[model samples]
Every structure is written in structure tokens, then in C-alpha cells.
Target: MAGDKELAGFILFLSQFPFLQAAKILTISFIGGSHYLLMDEISRILHDNGHQVRMFRQFGDGMLPGRQAQQSPYPVSTYSLGEKYLAEYKALFTEAQKDNLMGRDSLQNFLIFLNELSHQCNVTLHQSDILNFLKEEKYDLAVIDGFNPCCFLAAEKLGVPYIAMFPGTFMNAAKVGVTGPLSYVPIFQSLLTDRMDFLGRLKNTFMYLGSHIVDKKMDALFQKVIDEHFPLGSRPSIADLHLRAELWIYNIDFSIEFPRPLLPNIQCIGALLAKPAKPVTQELEDFIAESGDSGFIVVTLGSMISSLPLVEFLKEMIDGFAKIPQKVIWRYKRSEWPQGVNVAHNVRLMDWVPQNDLLGHPKARLLVTHGGLNSLMEAVYHGVPVVGIPLFGDQYENMVRVKAKNMGTFIPPDEMKAEKFASTIREVVENGCYKTSAMKQSVILRSRPFPPDQQLLGWVEHIIQSGGGGHLRPYSYQQPWYQQFLLDVILFLSACVAAIIYLILRVIRALIYFISNRKQKQN
Candidate 1:
């Protein structure tokens, strides 16, 4: 790792600059897709901070929250993932889903494809495009998601500080010596198992290792790309490429995800959504009020997990809704259900419902969710118990945390039997434990008086004023390969070999002398 690039980023120092003048903060944030609502919240926070924010969002054609529709986030932007890219990425995801890469072995293969694709976007194609744009229209700072290292590449080349922010409970950042909450999820411990079984633990260990491999491979791929583009007689090493920024902003509150060792570079502003938007509709309230004795349940899956994909399974959910006495308000894709399933007088389904609003309603009882971070936060915010039906990726682990907190039940999609699903929802709604747990979480969320948006702004300003994060920039000694320590083992073995050789030589000389003495005696 000689001549490796120093990763930029440290705690944003707040003291030096005059507070009178406005600062320009150019932001680029997208990790594969804009389907994540969490990005919107981050965008919102930056805008509230009075920073001039420019964005680059992928996978969606819609206008960014702060910008005009005519001129989008990027310099020359096309929301379309070209037909060839689409066909290939779809094929890859399809194969992964079919193979159930969540199982052992195939997981690494799936991860490699994902990382390579992400690298192509962040490092190769997207990185230079943004840099050229920045060169013409320069901005002070860039903030983006941590996993998307390519965005940071441009920031490094431009000599600007960029912050890498992780959305949810990501594990490897801690292992990489970054400050954050590592997913404390037990290995493969799904809905039924309290802890990970043997195969599950093995799978977890491999995934943990696999992520690092993916990171290494990503760095290699980016380095190759950079070398190809510039070819500057000699190239910058890949480590020289992936550096941390002047500051790190974690969109999480310490009150909830607690016990983290605070690092100056890493800032937590998670509770920005604590003063959430008010419910837009009042008609939705009338329906909830009607669900009298038993109360109502809310069903919602996050943005990425499509309601279209689960349409068939939803038929069974419709059937389950008929059996329960409590009313159900499902945030669905289509405005109406198929003809026959609409028979239940207790159920009201809409293509879209204001979810947080419905959950806050007094009649709201239990929640059926896909367990995305936003939904998780809302549920915790309202103190509503969840029956999580995790679809993919981090959802399973997110739900596991919910259950551990005594605030939810989880049923993996594979194990979602119709009767079992309904029964579990009924048990959670009727029983006292789930609600009690939700109330407890709600208290924790509400206990903190201050909103996090201001704190986020303060930190960003700190970075600008500090002349790059000098405080958080680590000294060089922290770098080492995992096997480098094993070199001592090599030295110890070499010493043993040398000792054996010395003994052999001594014995040979001694025997030669003894023979000479015997010969002399004979003479």
C-alpha cells in the first residue's frame, strides 16, 4: 500500500469562520437508486441548513426536492439506465433472486457483481462527469452515501472535502475503523430462531468477509478505470483513491441507536424527522375512527420493495383480512382490489395512504411492514408494534432489531403462510405486549427536546470553517494488513530452523574430533 491515498474526512471543526457570510455546499448523493425516501430527508436537511445544494440521483426521472425540473442534478443527466445496462442488471438481479444468494456460497458472487456495477457508476463513468461539472461550477463541499465511493473520488481529485453517510445500520464501517453502529444482528437468526444456527453463523461470517472483498475489488476496479482514463505514465494507487471526507454525517440519533463511541468526524443527526410532516388528509382519519372495538392495522412496504412484485401474495393477505375483526388500511399500488376481495366491510385499501398519519391515529393498532428504515422510524415514532415480513437485504436484520426491542414480530417471506400471518397479526394487535413495547420506544424518541436538522447544519458549517477535517484525519500508523501480524510467526519459525542447523554443525565437529582422538589412541 505504498503511496496509498490518504482518505479525507474528520470531525467538522466549528470555531474558525465568521458566521455572517453564507457558504456554498455542493452535494452529490445517490447509492444506485433514488427509490430510498431517506435521501429526501437528507436533501431536506441540507436545504434547511442554507447551503447551496446540487444533487445527482439515479434510477428515477422525477425532480429532486430542491431543484427545478428543467435543469436536473447532474451536468448532463439522463434518468434512463440505457436499455443494455437495464437488461444486464435485471438479468443479474433475477439470477441472484432465483439462486437465493441469501444462502451460502453464491452470496459472494452476487456481491461482486453488485460492487463492480456500483464501481462503474461511482468511480469510472459518474466520477469524471461530476468532476468536469464541478470544475466549471465549483462548490465548497460534497456529501454523499458512504458505500458509493466513486462520488468521493471526484471530491478527492477536486481537493474538496466530502462526507460519506450511511443510511441505516451498516456493519462494516465499524470494522473499517469508521465510527457507527455495526449491525448487531445474530447470524441467520430469522423469525423462528433466537440466535443464528451453525450454517447461519457460517454464512454471516462469510458475508462479513465478503463485503471487504467487494470493497477491495471495487478499489481495484476503480484504479484500473482511473489508470485507463488518465494513464499518467504512472497511476495513483487505488488506496490513494478511496479517502474519507472532512466530516462524516450519520443520519441517526444516539438516543435510539445508543452506546456508540463518539468520534469527532462522525456526527449523528438521525432525529431530523422527529417533528415529522402532518397528515395530509382528514378523510383517512374518519375511516380509522370507524374501526371501533378492535382498532385498525396498517400495512406498508417501503419504496424499493415493489407492491407490484408482491401482488399475488397480496391475494392471500386479502383473504386473511376477511378473517380478522380489526380493520386494515393497506398502502397499496392500485386504487382498488380485484372485484371479489372487496367484500370485507372492515377493510379499506387505497393505492396510497398517508402512513405516518394513519399510524398516529388513536385507533391504529398493529403494523405489517417490509421493515425499511423509514417505516421502522415511523413505527417507532408512533409507538406502534410491527409484524415485519422482510423481503430482502437488510430488511430481515432491521426487523430482528424491532423484535429484540419487544416492539415487533417478523415473518420472512418464505415462511409467510396465510393462516400463520393473520394469526400473528391478530396476536400482536390483541395482546398487550407489542403495544407496551411501542409506547416505550415512543418515549425514547420524544424524550429528546432538540431537532437534529440544526445539528446537521452546524456540522456541515464546521467542516467548511475548519479548512478540511484536521481533527478527525487519522495519522498513518493505523494502516496494516490483517496477515502482516503473522510475519512474527514467520520470523519465529526461521529462528527455530537456524537453531537446528547450529546443533547439527556442533555434533558433526564433535564427532570428527572424537574419531581423531580414537585414532591417535590406537597409534
Candidate 2:
């Protein structure tokens, strides 16, 4: 039979790596384009190594076509969240684009939005045939996007050991417990550098507490949904699932992100999604060739920012692009292009752009980005300087690092103006320091012990062969937070010291009283 031949071929191929065994790997991702890219790479790596890989991704429009899995080597299944949920997501994004001061209220709204998403995911998964698929597939490992709880729930129902993939900078501060005193490491959504002054450190501590609070509240909300869906008996809490993950693969590097104390189970496989840059189309090549010495700037605000609500913001970008002599390629996703605007001959607007290829082009001078991790990593891989216009979420933190590393300057979205934007663009394009710094970072990023894909493949196989690598988990994950941080020890020692001081004071008082009584009797 054809199935028998396929099985035999896989067995023979896997024989080349005697110590390694092929695994049935399942990657679960939803909603985000960048997440799909990461998961697709994971699936590709596993499949290329003679493993059976299956992917379950959410189906929807508005995702960039380029990020989609075109000709995947393994089987992929899709789930639908429907237009109602899609509209809700759009509303959330529109609300975020308003650029209100990120305070407690904003964080609360964000958490509530995430809960709504979790409910939608729960409903979709329940409606889909995912459980039956899992039963038939008999998967050996489940790779899940850690940000969402739905996949975690699926993996649990299937009763499979899994690892979590965090596609961006550290999201769970409490889980990872990164370097420095709590005051030093900035919290999620913190637009701060690692080197904090007194006030900054104070703010950082509050942000840490605030994040923990928000996570606890969010966990409870998600847990209620999990209970409803899995109402058989007690299920593991979401935090428990995170702690039990055999390994965590982060998409950031220490060269860009601040150094943190990572656990043995954690690893950074940055920029693994990018392949060797392919040549652009002849038309694009001609456009770049005609630009001559003045190279073009590639501008994109990432896939999530589909439309600009403010007409002035779009006009400002247009005005800035028209003034620049170098050719411009702006990748904007909007159903209707704004009217009453004069687009310059040097500027080109399209729904999507070949971002990685263009960044690698010889005639590419600079990149203007919204500081998404995927965009930043690609820009760094190609040794291109960036002009970061941070909008929200980790974008602000990502740009802060860009500026800290001297690779670029950050222009806050609220403070953007045509003249200032153009001036800053000119400054980065004209300055050699930015380019030198970016190239230096590029060298550091590429100087890993091994290629990122191979490294990831090795770790993933190790997890599979070693029975989820249970030995790699830190002892601290099992310990209470107070004990892990030695807070309990500190408290016990302080209590003993206070008791000894009290006893010493009582003995001294007794001695003084005896001396006074004897003196009085003699007199």
C-alpha cells in the first residue's frame, strides 16, 4: 500500500540519526500572523526530520498571505472563529490605536478582551472536530502558543505532554523570574530600559506588582471557562500547565533584549523563521536599480495594524515620504485608500510587501517599522537600521531597546509629525553610526553556537527522546514563590533576631532593677 511505503521511507530516513526518533508533533496557534510563522517553522523543522507533524491554525481573513503556510510539508487543519469574533478583535485593536495613557483601566480592559477571546476559542474548539483528530493522530508532543489558553486546554484533553512557544519577548514575568532584583527588570508593556534610575526602579516594582495582579485575575477568568468546558473533574490551572511545559522557546535574543536569568528549560531561538533571502521580482528589482545611489526605505507597520483611524496620520506619512528623495515602499492594509492625497512618484503603496527580501536588497538603506518582534528580528538579520514608530504593547519596549543599542531612534506615535518624522529619517539614513551598530548586532546575533533551526531541532528531539526532559526543570518551579526567593528564610531570621533583642533587653532591665534596690537598702 502507499501508506506502508510512506511509513517505510520515514523509518529508513530516521535511521540516519540513530539516537533520535521521529515524533508526532502538533503545533497549535491562533489569531496572530507572527504566531503562525513561528509555529509553521516549528512544524517544518519537525517534518523535515522525518517526523509526523500536524498543525491546527485559526482561519480568518486580514492575515498577510505571505505569512500563511504555503506548501507545508506536513498536514494542516484549520479552525474558524467566525466573523463576530473577528469584528470584536478589530474593535479591540481600534480601541488600542487611540493611544490613551496605559493605566490600570487600560490594562483591565485588555485583560477582559483576552478573556473574551478565550471564550471564543473555547467555543470554536468545542464546535470543531479537534478532539477526534487528536484521538486519531496519537501525537507524541504538543507545541502550543503560551499566550492563549485554548490550545493548552486541547492538549490537556488529549492527554499529551507539550511544550509552550512564546513568539515574542517575555510575557510572564512571574513564570520566568528573569535577572536582577525585581526593581531592575521592567514589566510587560513597560516602555522602559533595563538601566533604571531611582524613580524608574520604583515604577518598575509597581509595574511588576500590577502585572502579577492582572495575570492572577486573568487566570481566574480563563479557569472559569476551562471548568465549563472540561467539567468532568478537577483540571490543572493554567499556571500549572505553564510550569509543567518541558521546555520554553523564546523568539528573542540577549543581544537585543536585556540579559535575564533563564531557566534550564528555556531557550532563545531568535530569527529562526527567516530563510535565506530570495531575490525580488524583476519589477521590484528594476525599481530599486533605478533608485541608484539613493537607496529606498522599506516602511511597514506590521500585519496587525491594518488601517489608520486618523486621516492626519496617513497624510503625515505620505507627506514625509513625498519629501524624501529615496524611493519608498509603504505596505499598508486598508480596504479603501484615503482620497484627496497626492502620492509622489518616488513613493509606492501596496497591500503587502516582500519585507525580508527587500530588507536584504543591496539598494535598501533603512527600515521604518512599528517594532514588532518579527519585523525587528528580520531587520537585524539583514543588518539594516530602523526608525521605530512604536504604537502599543511590546512595540514600545522593542523600540526602547533599538534606541538603547544605538541601532535607531524611537518616535512615539502620539508625538509623530511630518517634519520631525522626515528629519529623524534623514538623521538615521545619513548617520553611519546607526548602520555600524546594526551590523555589529547582526554579527552577534549570528554568532550562536549553532544555527537557530538546528539548535531548535536538537532541543525538540531531546525533549521527545528524554520523555519531556523532566530533569531540565528547575527545582524552583516546584517551590513556593516565598521559598524560591528566600523571603521565608529572611523572615524567619528577622524573627529570631527580634526575639534575641527582646530577651537581652529584659535581662538588662532586671540587672538595673536589682542594682537600684541594693543601693537603696544600703542608704
Candidate 3:
């Protein structure tokens, strides 16, 4: 019943349907947290659909392997975890942390890390060593990441169909002449429903295998893919990734993000996380009661953007809430408060918090965020307004959605001053538009016929019933990116330009020499 509703909602809004079937798919990812989430979902969908699935995931806990890949071809397969890649992963992080040429500014550090991550991603995916693990299996379609385009090569070498699956928030999926972006919204999808404050959540970490801990460990496993295929060209460039696919499947849906550019081959799958049988926990109810009117706000910068690095920013935010009678619960990583900033009387801090639960809570009046897609969706799900402070990656673009819907205000990372922070919070609180838009978003979410998970699973089954995702194949994969970009002729033009410049320089030199020789003869 729930599934039907999800599909109904999606069908109502799906401006267009994508050609999303595949047979004998080589699904791959480095196994980082979000990436793993996307890849796993893809594998599950493909597998459930009755298609032959070959998964090359780097971050298999003890259940997945590193070197030798296990193959099932169809009915079943076991992807075991391995620790062979840990030392190298730690080394990379150590090197990355050590290479932190950027001082304490977390924002710059994030940018630099993003650059390094791009470079590193290219290095790991292209390793010849992984080819040894490729079973005697054939893939009809392929899925690759924009960050690591090496899968294009993998698909070409394997002679199969290819598609790009982006778990991260990106906008290239909506570029010119395509029609897929209409349904894509970047967000994380999880089934666990629990409510715990920052500290209580941290306190709960050891009790159960928390997603946070699992993700960190998973990132290590995924890092190996980079270790195997890196340092493309003498100089590092993500351009080296150059892996192409027949279609690109984005782990985002369009209901949350409207006005997206239309594109072909790029499909929206953001609502992939919405699953049936999701249960709520008690810890959630207590937190909402604690807020006691004036409604508290949930402030999180996400895991990638640290609260410690944004100490001054956090201080300003806390100060802003202090002026108002509302409560402010910040997901602060640090144990102690720094000087020059007083923790607001109604504020609480912890290393991590149960975000989904907190967002659902009635007290979650407004959300102050770095505009990570996952958080944005959670806020949208509960109809809570947002105050976006986008930092990097998709955050900037995602915030545009926040502003477009009149959902809330967006404060750039640099413009986030104490005074502005206070005023923005007040405005979001006092203003009717923000809440009205939030409620509209909530209606949009609830309006969907099926939850996200059902839509995702139904599509998976749709592919399987059809037999090996042959229907999903593109007309052809003959055009390379160079051909697509016209770089071949551009290279020829560059050479021509160089030759002309050389010839012109030679003529100028000859003229000068002739003039000198003539003057000497005259003398």
C-alpha cells in the first residue's frame, strides 16, 4: 500500500520517465559513506529485478572482499569485506591531514580536500591490479561516478552498457539538451528512525553499529579503489577519470528540487531512500517535549564540515539564538566551549545527533545548515524551514532550491556574521512565508503515492521482469568524450596555432637580421 502511494506521487510528478534497465550490470563504487549508500541501493534494485549484477564495491565491511571478487551472476553473490586496504587509507588521510597547507579554516581545508579527493579518486579507479579481480562475467550496462570516470574505460574494455550513478550532490546531471534533471533532488536515504541528542547519540555509538562508525570504516574500504588506479598522467587531473556511461543515474529526486535543467540520459533517483516499515523511537518524543514552546532549532554543518572548525560561526549562531527565547541544539564536535563565545542558555552541543528524528520533532522550528542534500530532504519531510549556509560541492546549488521555493534564507559561508545570523533566525521565525513554504514542501512529500523506497524497488523489479537490462541500452556508445567535446580538432588547432606563432617569430627574426646585415654592408 505504501509502495503504491510512493509510485503514484512520483508518477504524478515525473515529467518524463528514464530508460533505466540493465542486464549484467557492473555496478561499482569506492564504498565511501554516501557513495556506498547509492551503489548498494543500485545493486539491491538491480539484483531484486532479476538482472545479473556484478558489484565492485571497495568498502565491504568484513562481509565484502578486497582483491578477489565473488561472483553470483544472478541468483546470489557474496561481497565480503577485507582489511588489506586500511593501512593505505589511513596513510592517505594522514597525508591529507598533513598536506593541510590550509590552516584551521575548515572551509578552505574542505576545498583543498575536495581537490585532493578528485585527484586521489582518479588514481584509485584505474589500477591494473583490479582487472585481475574481474570475473569471466559480461556486463550489459555499467554505472560510474562523475568523481571517478574510470568506469567508462572499464565498460569499454568489458564491452557493455554504462551509466553514471552519482550519490553526491552535483548539477552536471541537469546540463543543456537533457531532460532528466526534472526529477532529481540530492539527499541521503536511510531507514533507521530514532531520536537522541548529540551526546546521547554519541553515547549510543558503542551500543549499536552506528551509521557514523560504519561510514568511517566504509570510507577506508572504498579508499583502496583510488590506491589501485591513481596518479593519471604525470600531472593529476580528474579529467583522467574520463569514464563514460550510456546513462547517468542520479541518487536524487525532483520533487524537493524544482526548476532543474532538463537533460537526456540523466535520471533522478533521489527518493531512493524512502523505504517501507520505518519505525519511530521514544527518545524522539522526549526531545520535542524538552523544547517547551518558542520551538527550538536544529543546527548542523554536516559531518564533512566540522563544528570545531566553524567555532566562530557556531558562536555567532548561538548568540543569535540567545537573543531569542528559542532553544538551539548544535551538533558541536568539541567537548568544551571556546573563549569569546558563550553557549546560549537554551543551547546544547554534542559530537553527533539523530538528525532525522530531530527534524521530525515538533520543536524543530527551523534548521540552520550547510545545505547538505540529506539534511535538506529531512527538513522538507517534516515541513521545517531552512536557513542554508552552503559551503561547497552541491551545497551551493542545493541552497538555490531553498531560496527558490521561498522555503528559507541562504547565508553564504563568508557572509555569516553574528548580526546577520541573529537577524536571519528571527526573520525565519517571525516570517510566515518560510513556514508556509515548508508546509507546502511537506504536502509535496506526503503527496507522493509511494514512499521513495517503493518507487526505487518497483523500478528495480520492472527492469528484472524484462530480462537482463538490454532495454536500457543506449542507441550506441560510439562517441567518445573527445568526440563529444570536439577536443581532437581542438588539439589540431592548438598545434596549428603553435606553428603559426613559431613561423611569425621566425619571420620577425629574419627581418631584424636582414636589416642588420644591410646596415653593415652599407657601412
* Best candidate according to lDDT: 2
Candidate order (lDDT): 2, 1, 3
Ranking by TM-score: 2, 1, 3
Per-residue lDDT, model 3, residue 62, is 21
| Candidate 3 global Cα RMSD | 14.2
Cα error of candidate 1 at position 499, Å: 11
Q: Provide the lDDT at 163 for model 2.
A: 87
Model 1 scores a C-alpha lDDT of 0.61
Worst 10 residues of 2 by lDDT: 97-106
Residue-wise C-alpha lDDT for candidate 3, range 1-523, written one tens digit per residue: 9999999999977746544544566676654544554566667776777666766655443222121234443433223223545555544444443333122234344444454444444544445455545545655555655444444444444455455666655443322123221113321121111333455444444323343343234234334444444344432222222223444556655546653453444556664543322333565355456668778788886553333444555566666677776777677655445777777787777556566667776567888887777678778777889998765556666776677777897887666677888888889878988999988987887677776666555544454444434455443333565875589999999999999999999999999999999999999
Model 2: per-residue lDDT, tens digit, 1-523?
9999999999999887657667888888775667776788888888888988898877777455333435777887877777987788777766666543222235656676677767776765585476687768898898888777777777877788888888888867576544356556777776778888898888888887777777778778777677777755667787787787888888888768887677788888888755558999898888888788989999888775655666777778778877777898878653556777667788877677888899988888899998888899888888899998776567778898899999998787767778888898999999999999998988888787888889888888889887786898878777888997799999999999999999999999999999999999999
Which candidate achieves the best TM-score against the true structure? Answer: 2
Candidate 1 lDDT, 60-117, residue by residue in tens = 3222222223423323322445557656765665455433312332446645665655
RMSD of 2: 5.9
Candidate 3: segments with Cα more than 4 A from true spot:
1-27, 31-33, 40-115, 122-131, 134-143, 150-160, 168-170, 174-244, 260-264, 274-284, 334-342, 458-523
Which pairs clash in model 2?
none
